[model samples]
Target: MAKALHPTQVIVRPLITEKAARLAEENKYAFQVHPDADKTQIKDAVEKVFGVKVVKVNVINLQRKARRTRTGHILHGQRWKKAIVTLAEGHKIELFEGV
Candidate 1:
């Protein structure tokens, strides 16, 4: 069985990007979550950390991609998971407010 994860451990960091900023306008925020964390865990973590009601949670498994270096060496990118969290109406996370 997998060990339980704390709120901080579940949510790695907020994904601050152009696309993410656009989604924030729609009451949606993206976060880089632990690979082992599920949608329910992500939902709980966001709500607990941000003190906001979560309307929905969506997760994406971003597979590692191959990259070629200048020396003709092949490398693979790190595999990570992303979570898109939609907050309830009238609620928003303060961290994303200034972005």
Candidate 2:
């Protein structure tokens, strides 16, 4: 059987919470990405979109947790991956500027 080679898509949004924003300014940018996305794809996407040299890419896979609704219905959260990309020192991406 032959498998398809669909390229992983990169979502162009950063986690801009207080902590994430601080980290981004400190050379660590956090992004919510696809679970199937690998380190190389992440690093390349970040560099290409942000125009910064990615030093390293750290991926974290998060498990979906079950949540109960007010109507007593239970549902599972979405499973996804997060990437913490470290950029070269002195190089910064201004996506969070004035935010």
Candidate 3:
């Protein structure tokens, strides 16, 4: 059987890009997540780890980009999925508290 994953495992990392930062300020927690993870898993994980109620979850699959390497060779970046989790009103996560 597949070993159970902790709440932390559900969320690989909180994406802190310019766009993600703005969403975070608005109580939207965005993260790069496992491609196979579903909405229910994401909701449970976010709430369990952050101790906050999840209002909604939006997921997007981002394709890897093809770029040129230093040696004039073509390479592909990694493909990953992203999840935008909206927390209940008045709920907040402290991950960006000091940043």
lDDT of 3 by residue, 14-60 (tens): 88888877888888878998776788888999988889999999999
Backbone clash numbers for all candidates listed: 0, 0, 0
Poorly placed runs, candidate 1 (over 4 Å)? 1-3
Candidate 2 matches the true fold with a TM-score of 0.83
In model 3, pairs of residues that clash are none
Give the deviation of candidate 2 from the true structure as CA RMSD: 3.2
Q: After superposition, how far is residue 50 of candidate 2 from its true place, in Å?
A: 1.4
For each candidate in the order shown, give its overall lDDT on alpha carbons.
0.93, 0.78, 0.86
Q: Provide the lowest-lDDT 10-residue window in model 1.
A: 1-10
C-alpha RMSD for every candidate: 1.2, 3.2, 2.5
How many backbone collisions does model 3 have?
0
How much is the lDDT of residue 49 in candidate 3? Answer: 85
TM-score of each predicted structure versus truth: 0.93, 0.83, 0.85
Pick the TM-score winner.
1
Q: In model 2, which runs have C-alpha deviations exceeding 4 angstroms?
A: 1-8
By TM-score rank, best first, the candidates go: 1, 3, 2
